[model samples]
Each structure stands twice: as structure tokens, then as C-alpha cells.
Target: MYILGIETSCDETSIAIVKDGEEIIENLIFSQIETHKIFGGVVPEVASRLHMEVLNKIFKLAMEKSNLSLKDIDLISVTQGPGLVGALWIGITFAKTLAYALKKPLVGVNHLVGHIFANFLRKDPPNFPFISLVVSGGHTEWILVEDYDRYRLLGKTLDDAAGEAFDKVARLLGLGYPGGPAIEKAAEKGRLIFDFPKIKCERELDISFSGLKTSMLYLIKNLQKEGREIPINDLAFSFQYRVIEELLERSFIALNKFQTSTLVLAGGVVANKYLQKRFSEVSKRENIKLFMPPPILCTDNAAMIASAGYYLYNKGKVDGLDLSADPSLEIF
Candidate 1:
């Protein structure tokens, strides 16, 4: 069966066609990073307006690029939550209308679960009974995935997500928006000289980045008071080192506690070179397998939504006209 998936949970407006749940026929994403950069970050209202303007064109492009027509699609899958309400409504309403017009099955997917299924796009997909880490712009979470659609939440960030921390630190250093890539580039030219204190909570797998972010800001402000101009590159490296170290430390602990044989990382933060390297090194030391999806899949994509939708579709789980965007949708 073929599924056409739509994703507009945030700043990206995406569309994709998946065949039989395994093959991605075409995945098209139009990013608003450049547009939002001037505003320092994504403005919810602007994002919603942009989605309203481009979603229809994107849908057409997705189908054309895949060399298929809407009539060839068997089902429609769309993300319906945990994002800006306006942005979510655009995609949700569009998908619902398309599904109704085509008389196809409509599956509303959770944005977080879409990130987890990103692993399926990898060459060596992580098996069941593995530890899943989803670190992104708005969220940081650890989940135990025993099967498709079956999950147990282990821990999550109580404050700002790792990606949010990255962006805020980058902004402080005069770096551009979409801060992860900019920070990674700067870190390459510098060394981690300053050691930032890591946050340790009573919970084993839980994480907190807000404290780290605050600490860095305070340190930088103090340095300025001393009439010292900080090296942006060194600061970037120091920040990344602490962030990645925390992620590695918590992941290792969870792997041992869960006795899982593999580790799977998803969400946009997975694209950070520092986290990727740290995760690989830590996983190797523990003799646990690691699976990371390609960079494209790491960010929001309809292909992952379609992949997740396949599991639900097969189980005869479909939504009716009552389906609407749930801004607080929980991941199952």
C-alpha cells in the first residue's frame, strides 16, 4: 500500500510518499530556517502563515516527484500534534481534506513517534528492545521501544531541550539561527578549555539543560566584566562538550539498566556531530550496537511519519473526521 504523509509540526513544511511502508518514493521539505533567522527564531504566527502558503504546492511536488498521482495513494498520514497549534492545524486540515476527497484511510501520527521511526530509514535499522533517545529543538526524551508503536517513556528534560540550549548559547555568542550546525562549525576550530558542571538529577535517565544554559550565560557575562573578549570557537567547543557528555553519560546508564543490546537516536539533535561522535564512542565501549538515521531523516520528515503510519495502518488503526491537531498529543 502507498501512503502520502504531511508534516508541518514546526518550521518545516514537508510531504512524502511511501510505498509498502519500506520504500520512500519521494520526500520533499521546504525549510523556513532562512526566513526565521532574521527574526532570531521561529515566530509561530509567521510559521503558520508560511505553511498556509506552501503546503499545497509541496503536496503537488511530492506526488509529481514520486511519479504518482493522488489516486495511486492508499492512505494519508499527517502529524497532528505537540507543536504550534496554528502550524499543526494547517497540515492536519489539509491531510483530512485530502483523505476525505480521495476516500482513503487517514492516520493521525504523534510528532515524537515520527522521530523514533526515523531509524527505519537506516541501512541497519536498530532492532526491538533497544534504548531510544529523541533529542530535538523542543524535546529531549528516552523511550524503551519493544516494538513498533509500543513504547515506555524512561525520562525527559524538565526544562529547555538540548537543541534549544544549543540555539540559545549560539545566539549569545552572536551565532546565527539553526544554531546546531553553526556551533558545530565553530567548535571544529577550537578546543574545550572550560569545563562546565554537569547537572545530576536523582532520576537515572532524566536530563536538564536549562541549568547548563544558565551557567554558561553567567560565566560569559563575568568574563566580559573582566574586560576579556571570549573566543567564540572555544566557547562553542566547551558548550558542546558538556552537552554531549551529559547525553552520553545518561544513555550509557539507560542501556545498562534496560539491558538493551542497541541504542537508537532520533530527532533533529541527532544531526549534531558532537552527539553523533560521543554516542558512537560510548556505545562501542559498552559493546552496544548503535543506529542513526541519515541527517535528512534526523530532522522532521514525512517519510518517517509514513513509516510510523505503516505500523498503525496494518493494525487497522485509522482516524475519522473527528481527527484534529492535538497540540499536547502524547507519544505512545
Candidate 2:
């Protein structure tokens, strides 16, 4: 079955066609990073407008690249929630129109769950009953995946998400927007000198980054007050270290608590080289199999959404035209 996936949950306007939820016939992503770079973060209004403008073009490109027509599409899948409402609405509306015109089935997928399912696109995907760490700009969550469409929320960020913290700290350091890559690049040339406080959550599986971000804020202010040169590289290294440490610490705790041997890393933050390297080393040491999607699928894309929609559709999940975008939709 060929599934047409539309994703406009945020700044990215993506359209993809996936075959049987595993093979990607065509995946097209139009990123708004350059447009939002000057703003230091995504502006929802601008993101929505960009999605509306580029979605059609992206869809056409996907079709051309895949050499497939609308009639070849068997299902329509879209990211329904847990994103900017206006942005989500664009994809939802476009998907509804296609479903109506093509007379195909439509399914709304949770953005977070779609991230997890991105692993299925891999040649050797992780099996069921695994633990997933989903870290993105808008969310930080640890989920226990019992099976496709069955997820148990183990823990999540009580404050700012890891990606959000990265962005704020990057801005604080006068780095460019989309802080992850900027900080990652800067940290490579520096050492981890600053000893940022480690977050201690009430729950063993839970994660917190608010205090860590505050600590960085004060450290920078103190340096400015003393007229000391702010070591941007060292600060970025230390900050990235502390954040990834907290994430791995909680991940280990969850692995031990659940006794799950398979671990899946998903979301935009998974693109961090440090996080990937550390997780790879630790998972090996602990004898836990780790699965992560390629960098292209790491960020927002329609392929994951289509893969998720395929499974959901096979399980008899379908939506009507009344289906609306839920910005706060939860994965159950």
C-alpha cells in the first residue's frame, strides 16, 4: 500500500509517499530554518504561512520524484497534534482535501508517536516492548512502547524541553538560531569546564532541564559582571554535556525499571552527535540494542507520519472529515 503523508506540524513543510510503511518512494521536506533564523526561534504565524505556501509545491515534487500519481496513493496520513495549531491546521486541511478528492482513507497521527515509528523505516528496526526517548524542541518524553499504537508514558519534562533549553542557551551565547547545531559545532572546539548542576527529579524516570538552564543563565551573567571573557565553546560544551547527561541518566533508570533490552531514540534532538555517540557507547556497555532513524528522518518529516498511519490504518483506525488538529494531542 502506498501512503501519502503530509506533515506541517511546525516550521517544516514535508510531503512523502511510503510503500507499506517501510520503503519511502519519495520524501520531500522544505525547512523554514533560514526564514526563522533571524528570529532566534520559530514564529508560529510565519511557520503557518510558509507551510501554506510550500506544501503544494512539496506535494508536487514528491509525486514527480516518486513517479506516482494520486490514484496510486492508498491512504492519506497527517500529523494531527502536539505542534503549532496553525501549522498543524495547514497539513490537516490539505490531507482532508486529498482524502476527499481521492476517496482514500485518512488517519491522524500523533507527532510524537510518528517520531518513534520512524525507526521502522530502518532496515533493522527495533522490536516491540522497547523504551523510547523522544526529545524535541516542543517535547521531552520517555515512552514505553508495548507495540504499534500502544504506548505508556513513562516520564516527560516538567519544565522546558531539552531542545528548547538548547535554543535559549544558544541565544544567550549570541549563537545563531536553531541552537542544536550551533551549540554542537561550538562545543566541538571546546572542553567541558563549567560544572552545571545536575537535575534531580522526584521520579526516577522523569527529567528536568529548567534548573540546568537557569544555572547557565547565571553563569553567563556572572562572567559578564566580572568583565571576564565568556568562553562560548566551553559553555556550550558544558551545557550540552549536562543536558545529555540528564537524558541518559533518566534513560538508564527507565531501562532498569522496565527491564527492557531495546531502546529507541527519536525526535530532532536525536540528531545531536554527542547524544548519539554517548547513547551508542552506553547502550553497548549495558547490552541494550539501540535504534535511531537517519538524520533526514530525525527532524520533522512526512515519512514517519505515513509509516505510522499505515499501521494505524491496518488496525482499523480511520478519521472522518470532521477530524481537526489538536495541538496538545497526547500519545496513549
Candidate 3:
């Protein structure tokens, strides 16, 4: 079965064609990062309008690239929640209208669940009954994946997400928007000198980055007070190191407790080279199989949504015309 997927849950407007959930025939993404960089964050209204303007073009491109028309698509799937309400609505409505018009099945998928499916796109997909760490600009969560459509949320951030913290710190440093790549590029040339805080939060699965972000801010301001300008690379390095350390530490705890051999990562923050390196080292040491999607799949995209939706569709889970976006959609 061929599934046409649409994703506009945030700044990215993407479309993909997936055959039987595993094969990606065509995946196209239109990013508004450059446009929203000036603001150092995404403006929900701007993102929604951009989706309206570009979704059609992206749809056309996906069809052309896949060499398939609407008639060839067997189902339509779209991200329906856990994102900007306006942006989610655009994709949901577009997909619903198309599905209704074509009289085809429509499936609404959770954005974070889509992120988890990103693992399957990897060369070696991890099996179920494993732990997944989903860290991104908007969310930070540890999930126990028992099987397809079965997610047990172990814990999550109480304040700022890891990626959001990175963006905030990067903006304060005049690094750029989409802070992950910006800080990563700068960190490559420098070493960690500043002693950043890594909040463990009592050895539980829960983690916190709010304190870490504040610590970075104060350290930078204090350096400036001493009439000193810290090298951007060193600052970036310190920030990345502290964040990766906390993430890996908590993930390892989960791995040991769950007795799972697989450690998987998903979401935009998974693109961090430092995080990837740390996860690789720890997984190797613990002899746990690690699965991480390539950078392209790490960020938001329709391919992951389609891949996840394929499983749901096969299970007879389809959305009706009355389906609406759930901004705080919970994964079960």
C-alpha cells in the first residue's frame, strides 16, 4: 500500500510517499528556518501562513518525484498534534480535505510518535521492547517502546526542552536560530572550559535543562563583567558537553533498569554530533544496540509520519472527517 503523508506541525512543511511503511519512494521538505532565523524562533502565525503558501508546491514536488498521481496513493496520513496548533491544523485540514475528496482512509499521527519511527529509517532498525530518547526543540521525553503503537512515557522535562535551551543560549550568544547546528558548528573548533551545571534531579528518569541554561547565561554575563569575551567555540562546547552528559546519563539509567539491549534516539536534537558521539561511546561500552536516524530524518519530516502511519493504518486505525488537531496530544 502506498501512503501519502503530510507534515506541517512546525516550521517545516514536508510530504512523503511510503510504500508499505518501509520503503520511502519520495520525501520532500520545505524549511522556514532561514526565514525565521531573524527572530531566533518560530512564529506560529508565520509558520502557518508559510505552510499554506508552500504545501501545494511541496505536494506537487512529491508527486512528481514519486512519479505517482493522487490516484496511485492508497491512503493519506498527517500529523495531528503535539505541535503548534495553527501549523498542525493546516496539514490536518489539507490532508482531511484530500482524503475526503478522494474517498480514501486518513490517519492522524502523533508528531513525537513519528519521531520515534525515525529509527526504522535507519540502516539497522531497533526492535520493540526498547527505550527511546526523544529530545527536540519543543520536547524532551524518555519512552518505553513495547511494540508498535504502544508507548510508555517514562519521564520528560519539567521546564525548557533540551533543544529549546540550546536555541535560547545560542540566541543570547548571537549564534543564530535553529541553535543545534549553529552551536555544533562553533563547538567543533573549541574545547569545554567553563564548568556548566548538569542537573541529575535525584537519579530518576526525569531531567532538567532550565538550570543549565540559566547557568550558561550567568557564566557568559560574568565573563563580560570581567571585560572578557569568551570564545564562541568554547561556550558552545561547554553547553553541548553538559547537555549530552545529562541525556546520556539518564538514558543509561533507563537502559540498565529496563534490561533492554537497544538504545534508540529520535527528534531534532538527535542531530547533535556531540550527543551522537556520546551515545555511540556509551552504547558500545554497555554493549547495547544503538539506532539513530541520519540528520535528514532526525528533524521533522513526513517520511517518519508516513512510516508510523503505515502501521496504524494496517491496524484499522483511521481518522474521520471530524478529526481535529490535539496540541497536547498524548501518546499511548
Ranking by lDDT: 2, 3, 1
Best by lDDT: 2
Model 2 TM-score (2 dp): 0.98
Deviation in angstroms for 178 in model 2?
A: 0.8
For model 3, residues 149-260, the per-residue Cα lDDT tens digits are 7889998898899899988888877888888888999999989788886586764989888888888788878989999977889989988888888889889889888889
Residue pairs with colliding backbones in model 3 are none
Please list the C-alpha lDDT of all candidates, in the order they appear. Answer: 0.88, 0.92, 0.89
Model 1 residue runs over 4 Å out of place are 122-124
- The clash tally of candidate 2 reads 0
The segments of candidate 3 whose C-alpha lies over 4 angstroms from its true place after superposition are 122-124
* Total clashes in model 1, counting residue pairs 3 or more apart in sequence or in different chains: 0
Clashing residue pairs in candidate 2 (N, C-alpha, C atoms within 3 angstroms): none
Clashing pairs in 1: none
Candidate 1 has its poorest 10 consecutive residues by lDDT at: 118-127
